[model samples]
Target chain A: MNTFVLLQVSEQVAAKSADMAAKDPHGIIITAVSVSVVFIALIILYFAYTFIGKLTSGQIKMPKIKLPSFKKKTAEVHPTPEEMAAIALALESKRSGEVYAAIGLALHQHMNEKVHDNESYVITIKRRN
Target chain B: MNTIIESLQQFWQYTGFANMTYQHLIMVLIGIAFITVAIKKDWEPLLLVPIGFGMIIGNIPITEGLNVGIYEEGSVLNILYQGVHQGWYPPLIFLGIGAMTDFSALISQPRLMLIGAAAQIGIFGAYALALQLGFNPAEAGAIGIIGGADGPTAIFLSSKLAPHLMGAIAVSAYSYMALVPVIQRPIMLLLTTRKERLIRMKPPRVVSQKEKIIFPVVGFILTAMIVPSGMALLGMLFFGNLLKESGVTKRLAETARGPLIDVVTILIGVTVGCSTQADVFLTGSSVKIFGLGLMSFIIATMCGVLFVKFMNLFCKPENKINPLIGNAGVSAVPDAARVSQNAGREFDKSNHLLMHAMAPNVAGVIGSAVAAGILLSFLG
Candidate 1:
């Protein structure tokens, strides 16, 4: 009897679905059902996440995984006094070269009058002259 | 001389000028206008430029039986268009979206998800309206998804339920998405009082990386269990999110969000635009779809704002939500969220609502996909 009743209910649902499929869909019912289903689904997500949020209110303790360092280790070598002096001279020469190049470019532009004057492009007439 | 004359006539017949119709000219002009707006106005240029160019390509008059048009089975355009028609591009697009999205805001404030669900009233509202206007249920469902403010979701649902209307629905969905700021701002302002706009709730709590990683996996299981039909879109979305959040798959996540999404976007945008051949797109139904789409967008914005106000009634004064951010409940992504920030700044410069608005904005993506799934289950 229980089996029969379950079968009957299943049949009724199938019939109802078929009926809905055959007819022009009842918009009100579709809207209500779709809205309800979407709400129910999202609401479930909301509650689940909310619960999770509460449970995990404190900081999560994740196991630290140590990654291999990619940096290469070089042996520390002390430069002799003469070597250090040579290195310093080379650095000074490079810095002076940059400065000289900039100065030369600026001087060249100035000498050639390549830089624009900041004068306003206004015309004045002198009638008396 | 007679043979030469016949050959000349054949050549003339094959030329575009000989076969040009007013419809083709009109569509071409529309394409040019799209390109102009995208360039001059700088609105959704990524989407509009490709689509506009594709529209011109689609509308160029061609002789029959040449297998050159998008509709021709063996044509290259048609082959590319299969992605759109077969409903695969949307899921791929969703994967990219998932990879790019930061669900921290939504995770921090789960209650805000309701606003996303409420905003979906526009989908059902449009569904009813479309039915009243004589569209069948499946077509109505497809048209209604435009309210979701999600181009890919609309395309996915329409491709499944109403293939014939996919082009019109896609164009309408994208057009309305581009117009979100224009449409949503006025409605947002109209619905909320000045005080409501100025309401500043507490900042969202910081979501831990564990929570972030857990969210996609759990979110997928729960949503999919409830609406298995939405598995295609929802699964891709969550999988993409998982790839991003897992920390172990940085390269994979980067690829999904970057190059993969870009390529899919170009293909989807241009092919969707190409699908709008003048013969298929120019119709009374297309006009009605546009009208319904606008109405749906307005309704969705209104519902989002109103629902926030409703939620505000139960909350304490300090917890009250600013209705301005509610407009972000439609899933237009950072654009809708940006509108909230801009509108809120108009009231209070310090009240930055962009982060808060993103909660509902991302939730709307899930809600719309679920809504699409429901429609598909019922109508597919």
Candidate 2:
């Protein structure tokens, strides 16, 4: 080989070796930086979550307030005693086959008499399933 | 009669038994052992059963260069194996894991995330050790990740940086993860005092739906920004979590967590197992990888336990952490968490640390993924 060509080849090889050497430093630095990043990021998230939990709990107490008491008008509509008895009678008739007819009869009897006595009735249905 | 005998001999020569070697017989026995452990011990049966059967199939010793092995160019096994070789299955597994994971535990107690970070000491420790033992930087990184005890992450990083070591690394990662109870229990018992083991963590606070939904978004943004190479693994993970938490994507979430994950797990386990041919797997390097893997796993477990003990020094009495749950920081998921709870129960039957352990366990998934990303970006 000629002297000039040998010098050129050696220079190229040295440059390549230097480049490879540079990458090792970079790799070590990256490893350290990466580990640090993971720790830093997680620690930051830890604090953020703590702050968020505290904020979202909404624990700030509100001051007590005093208000003037005022009497207000209320609705006066109430079921009459007869109507109440009819309602009870209708509900009691729900289990029988003639429930509609019984309900009609109860309503008619309550309308016919201005005052009605309280009565309770029980009925049961059997299922065949 | 002579011609008939010759033809019969020719036919027999083509059979798998004709080509079988002692290595194949040994691998078959190992495969059976895996299956026995899966069935008898009930340790990671979902993974071990498939992988074990695949190992048997892989070791059947067919005629050479017949295009039938997993390494063949056009075989069906090779095609299925691409999901692993090309790094597809791991991210999909992560997606399913995300859909199934409840970040509520980690969110409720963020300090536990530090334990997850602490567990990553195993990765670096193993990496440095592997380098000293003569692996190149890329192969060392892949071996180190087995210490993370996250099989998918190990497979993902290996597929990128050290494809030749993928089989050993994957097998080692899964084996250690499956043996989390055996490996972690002793270290956990030795590291923690009885009082530390018995410390019952306060109940985790209830996380709101809004926080659950926002977590994936914020977490993805933060972690991905730091390590872009992890986007496939970490992105799918967060996306799967978003599906579950979005409330409107119930069907997608169900599919991701159910059929999708099941399918990916089978593909990953079987393909990884099939990659473990006797010739490729019985190398000196494979033995070293396995050794480093066990060491990394033990170191990671110890790091987590020690970290908790260290943290306890500054903790108030009421807020002191139980070192038992620290094993979960190695990222074996519910298995490690279960071990932590079992260890805690042994110390105090009344103590239940499963929920608390879950926080670090799931956090370890993200931690390992981040570490994998860093290694990939640097070494890849």
Candidate 3:
């Protein structure tokens, strides 16, 4: 009984193998060829890129087109007495290691683009009123 | 009274509600699932949302004789599907991709392109397996292209070789591409060790604008000569890059990358989704195709990771590469590159691998296109 079962199983396995081979007769060959072709194509491209990289590494240069430059107008204004006092306070604050705050305050005051009356004059007028 | 009853019966028979089938209902549900995933999980919403909605429209049953569906002659949907059927959309899609692509990363580190080439092992691998599984040469070739992880190239090749499998091949390619992060992470971690993952690559050398402009031109001539079958896709890709890098054609490049690509993508996605009817799409072969597609993806990622590890054996200590970027070699574009960055960040926060990863990521695009051309030459 054991021999009979083993023989039948072997026959079934052979039949299945034959059936698969019949369906795709050149399966292994096609697989090999397709794989080789992909690698070969890529290998060719790799060398092409490498060769191009060597030939054109630093050989090409684009022409520089010069553009006309336009200068913007700038006006410098004198600092008010209040501004000087603010700068002094900022510098004093720097001595206590608040350098960033001091520099920020000084730059903000100096960089303000709007024209205004001196802080001292404005304060005096308001006090009098 | 008898005439009126007959007229009512005729109307009921002609209605879409009476014509609907279980397959139609199943396909519509699948479409709804696609939309839900796009909205909730945010996976490739740009492509998925349109494709999902188109699937719903495709599954709606109409009268047998009416020219209304994508398969029907002279139908509106059929007109839109011509781009996919005639293999016109992929090349135009390549044009948009080219205009927006910056090849500096690949040019600066050209050797990384080999990892992209090596990743294509999955294509050939899957091709062989498909053949053994009883697919004919043409169908096997189309199925194998799904391994490239490039939707346009896959569509182009399948449309030429096995037009019947185009829908299944395309849907599988795009779906796997969208799942790059989910699919590639574990394989990346498995192949790479902690030490290998920690390896930091040298920053890419700054490529000049002149080199950039010449690259597309030189690449066009060389690659076109190698595989003439790939000219439509490769030629448009190079032309688009030239438009962008030439600096004088900013308007053309802008239009190609922006509106032109958007329109083509919409058409490609919608048509691909609409092509998947229940009777045609849900076949035994489709199940096998999906299985092969997943295997191809995993094998491609594995090959890339292993190839990098193999390359490290010869390189000097200073020139060592991180294996994390190897996953980018499968050519899903920025998504695969972004996955590399995310994986790297998991190990070392300071490591920025996006630029490094882009080299292989873009190279994979070229690699897949070349592989497609070769398959076409052999099988088509």
RMSD for all candidates, in order, please.
15.9, 12.6, 17.6
Per-residue lDDT over B1-380 for candidate 1, one digit per residue giving the tens place of the 0 to 100 score: 99999999999999888988998888888889888988998878888888888889988888878888887776898889879877889999999999999999999999999999999999999999998888877778889999999999998988777777888898889888888889999999999998898899799999989999999999999999999999999999999999999997887899999999999999988988887778888999999999999999999999999999999999999888999988998999988999999999999999999999999999999999999999888877
Residue B263 displacement in candidate 2 (angstroms): 0.9
lDDT of 1 at B54: 87
The per-model lDDT (C-alpha) reads: 0.88, 0.84, 0.83
Best-to-worst order by TM-score is: 1, 2, 3
lDDT of 2 by residue, A10-129 (tens): 233334324434576224554567668778767877877776666667653456686644322223457889999998996786476587777778888876783477563323466799
Q: What is the TM-score of candidate 1?
A: 0.82
Tens-digit lDDT string for candidate 2 (B112-223): 9999998988888888788778776777888999989999999888877677788899889988888998999999999877777778889999998988888898888888
The weakest ten consecutive residues by lDDT in model 2 chain B span B131-140
lDDT for B297 (candidate 1): 94
The candidate that wins on TM-score is: 1
Q: lDDT by residue for model 3 over B207-259, one digit each (tens)? A: 87877887788777777787888899889999999999999788789999999
DockQ of each: 0.19, 0.11, 0.11
Cα shift from native, residue A118, model 2 (Å): 51
Lowest summed lDDT over 10 consecutive residues: which window, candidate 3 chain A?
Answer: A1-10
Query: Which residue pairs clash within candidate 1?
Result: none
DockQ of 1: 0.19
